[model samples]
Target: MNSKDFTAGLAELRGLRDEIKTLRKQLAKLETARDKQITALAAYEKAKAERIAPAAGVSVADVVALAPTLAPPAPPQPQEEPAPTPQAATNAAGRPEPTGVPAPDLRRAPGKPAATGTAPDTTITGGSDAPPAVGTPSSHPGPGRQPTTTPAADGEQPEQVRELPSIPPGQDGDTWFTATPNLTSTRPNFTQQPRQMAFLDATTGVLVHRDTTTRLNLGTGSVADILIAVYATVPATVERIYITAGDPWHRDAERYPFLRDAVAAWLNGPLPDGWKIESTRGRDRLAGHLVHPRNPVGRWQRGDQHTEIRSVGEWFDPDGATPATVRDAFVLLWRALHRHWPDVTLMGSPSQTGRDLWSRTIPTKAGAKWADGYPVMSEEIRGLLHATAGQGRTELITPPKVPDRLPQLIELDRTFAYAKHTWASGVGIPRRITAAAFAALSEKDQINALFAPSHWHIRVTIPHDWNHVGLLPAPAAGDRTWHYPAEPGRTFTTWAGGAEVNLALRNPHTPWKVEILDGLLWEAGSPLREWSTRLKDAWASLRAIAATHGDPKQRTAAHLASRAVRAILLYGIGAFAQRPRITTGTVPTGAEHDIPTGAQIIGTDGHTITWQRDTGFARDPYAHPEWAAGVWSAARAALLSTKMREDNLFVGALHLPPGSVVAFRTDAIYTTTDPAWPYHGHPGDYLKKGHLPGPVTGPRTEDELLSLQTLGRAHLAEEQEHHR
Candidate 1:
């Protein structure tokens, strides 16, 4: 507050004031320059815009009219045209008028300023430089607004440039477009046409055009005609068409048209002979449209019931008529379309396998040219064999010839018989016969020999009762029972029973002929002979056995007795008893006139053997004790003949079959004198009684004999079975 402080403060204040004045002056000058530069820049931009707008096919009026709507709206006026308010602007139509129009009030009222211009402090939409002038309504007045006109002054419209339709979300660019490099409004653009097929006759070489909906008519004239007809008739697009022709079965390559050359090559590849072909057809429909005149734009819709036939039958049946024809038409169609659109789906019957049958034969005359040598199979022919024959071995057609001989002839006969048997069995003989079947037969002999043909016929009839006793006559009048012949230079010794004989022989050149030996040798080592001889030998053997240990006279008696017993057993007599012996004592005796004229004693005492149901000797031992004593004495003498106990006994002639034993007893006798004679009598007693005996034991009663024979055979069979 002191005067000195006041004065100092005043001086400082005056200095500050002078500095403020100078700074203020500099700031004012800078502001004026900036304002001028901004005004000049705005003018330059406006001029540049006017110049560029028309060059770009836009006018200044259009540019200005389309300028950024950066300016704000003015105050609203009364609904009524304020009767030419003195200060308001007016048009030539006399609406309103104004002398000074406020310069667009560049200072924005508030908030954000116009985006069209840039101040050093503001962010411009197009950075500091303006964007190229776009069309806009002009500030000056314009007229004649048309509804479809662009926003240009004077309504001079700019041509409309439309954007191409957007591609369907994603697809190949050219899928919907045709390759038209020279396209123009005046020229008609073209697109690819659909592919079509033309079927051709395999036989007559006629082409058939089959469109989407038409069947290939047999009457089709030419490939071109068919194509035109199909194009005119089908309800589908037509792009490509062609004809095919050929006989697929035949090997001639010149038969098919140009398009089918490749197909023919594939089908006619090498194949063996003796193969037959078969093709099965399908009834499935195609998977494309079929629009005929009656059914325009009809689609070949897929359905469960697929039934349609478009291709000709010749494609499968080349002859179109016969069942014997072989063909591969499917392959033809496949090759024709494979190069183009293989994905074009085909609908038809389920697939089936095809077969080819081919056979080749050389005549017998042709075979004769080879001199009966094995004909070698050609490798070329083998290469063409059916595909299934990969595993078969190549072989000659004919067999080599064998040398002539009896044994070889027998073998040839046997072979012929076998072949004939096979033929009778109904099995098909192969086309080519192999040589091995009758390798032993000479080819020349086969070709020229008088080898007679014979057929086998076997007739068998079994009796209703197996136990029935009956005679089986010999097959022929002179044919006797079979006898096994002993091998030459062999010796045999029979068992005491005389049923079997043991033999020893050496075989050098051949196998033992068992079949012949079995029947030939009744006993081992016995010589083979006629049945009569066999009977005689048998009788002699029995006599020798009887006399082995008996009195001289009684030995003879025993031999006779044995012979009688054997005859009885062979004749199958069941019963008999003692009969008188007549030593020619009753011939024409004084009592002989007492007998009936036709009746006479067939047997008698002494010289004649006799048998009776009851034991009564003409010379009774009681009436004549001496005679009885003599009889007993004679019997004792006869009973003494035997070396072995079994020899004296009634042992079976042969061993029993397996699992059995022969039974006999020396005490047993075949004589009528024996107490059991009536029940168990031999043939001797029946002869003495003047009656002929039946078969030995009658059917099953004599089965023991068969068992005996089988027993002997069984032992022999054991060795043979082991060898087998």
Candidate 2:
């Protein structure tokens, strides 16, 4: 087959190879386009599934049935022309500048069917004729108008714009100032904000208004000057005016009188018709009220009003100086009397005129007579003079006897005695005297008295050899705290005229001491004149009793009896009564242990009796029931048979007030064994051991007890009277 045939076939085979390569390249291009279409269809199916899955609850049959009537997708429309750009504006520097216009939104193209659920652009722009953005917030939007816009010109880019929420008028807007009104019924609306300034007026109530801008400097002005300026503002409204005064203002009014005169002048002066100035006398700044003359009948009544001319500064200083003129006079008189009584030896050497003269003696034919200066004493002295005149070498040196002046002397003596007692007790004037003084003085006067000076004579005594005694540190100036050491045997003396002693005694720490010394000291010019009189009378009566009671034994016996009765009544009864309790065993619970009637149970002392149902009588009168009734009867008879008489002994004339409970030790036989008992070996032998003494026998009920007490007191008073 030859070389020529082989070469021609090889050329033809090369041409066929080139044609096959071209066909293969075209098939590869078609496959690539087909792959692209397949990917697009897959994405579309996925999206469709996602949208339908939310409504999967719908039956598939219903979906298929509706599918036949469903419209096919709309064909894609043509794209619209791009927004036209405006001509560029030239700036002062000759550079092309933006027209401040906004470009159209490319997010929603013109021809592409709008996607469902896509948000509409509500952005605003600068063009007046542009349609309003689809969802622009507007109270009233015009139809067919696009949002105004200013598009960028050729070769220019638009500036970035920020969307802001629109705020309607009347709602809060973005601004620096906000207004809020507090006044509901009334309002004072000013074009511009007003500056607040207080206005002072006398007669008007609080009034607010805004008109004038006159501002006065009141910082350095006098009250009167400020008031005048305020009044000069004439018809101006006022909120309030403050009035105040200090100590000096009242002092000036009191001392100078001209200050008050000036005030009266101001009140009567010509002022605004409606202006009425109310002034407080002192530091009280409360608004003053003027009640109508006929308030109950009047239609309108005046209310509290602020003062215009108010003084606020302090004026006077307090005067703490104490006066001692009366005390000095007393001391002088006392010294003079001491000198006058140079011959008087007894009764402590008469260092003071107020010392008692009872101990003073005058030599007489009858031996000696007391210089008490009683009216009856004068007659005795005359008789003594008559008897001694005839006796040779008989020189009767009689002490001066002025019966008429005895009352004053006695009063002085009593006062000094009280003062001495007060000093000794380490307490100032007693509470009784203080109460009497308080009852007589007004509240204001009492306050004044607290600050007022009164005479005081305090003597502080320490141990003789102990030299540690010294004045306590002075209290801080104006501090009223006071301390007085109440150590035993210490005497305090405060002789100057001041309330310091009283203040110290009145403190809570000193109440007991005050009570102990009550009615001992008298304040100068105090209203307790009755105390002095009563004390003087009592002293005179006592002295007279001493003079008349010649039998010392009888007097001694009576005194002893009186003291015994007082001891039994006060100490035995008021301090020793004990409640009965079962002894030696727990209280019996069963009825088998019958407590016998009249069974004695021992008490501390005294015959007061009490019964315990389980423990028997606490203080039985007798060991045997039969003897109990007889003993009790006898005691009652003995008490009842006794009559109230001058000779009967009792406690002092002072009787215990009614309803006072007298606690006493009940006399009973102690069954408990005691080592000290005389019948210690015989535990039941109460009589041999000697039972406690019984209480006073007569009184039964509280009333009867009180009656007996009254009788005893009367007897005491009678004895005192008889002696006097």
Per-candidate alpha-carbon RMSD to the true structure: 66.2, 56.2
After superposition, candidate 1 runs with Cα above 4 Å error: 1-233, 237-315, 321-724
For all predicted structures, in order, the TM-scores are 0.12, 0.15
The number of clashing residue pairs in each candidate reads 52, 37
* Model 1 local distance difference test score: 0.22
lDDT of 1 at 488: 26
For TM-score, the strongest prediction is 2
Q: Pick by lDDT: which candidate is best?
A: 2
Write the residue-wise lDDT of candidate 2 on 1-724 in tens digits.
Answer: 7999999999999888778767766775875665454334335533332223235433222221122111122222224533322321322233332211111122222222111100112101011211222222212111111112222111122232111111111112111111111211111121211112232222222211233334444332333444556545634334223222121112223432344332322222333344543433322122232111111000111133233332211110111111121112222222322343333221111111111221121112221111112111112212221211111010111112111111110000001112111110111111111222322333343333323222222222222221111121111112212222223223222121122222222211111111110111222221112222332343333334334567654333233222222222122111111123232111122422454554432211121221123332233110111111111211111111111122222111011111111211111211111112122111011122121122334333446434544454455456557999
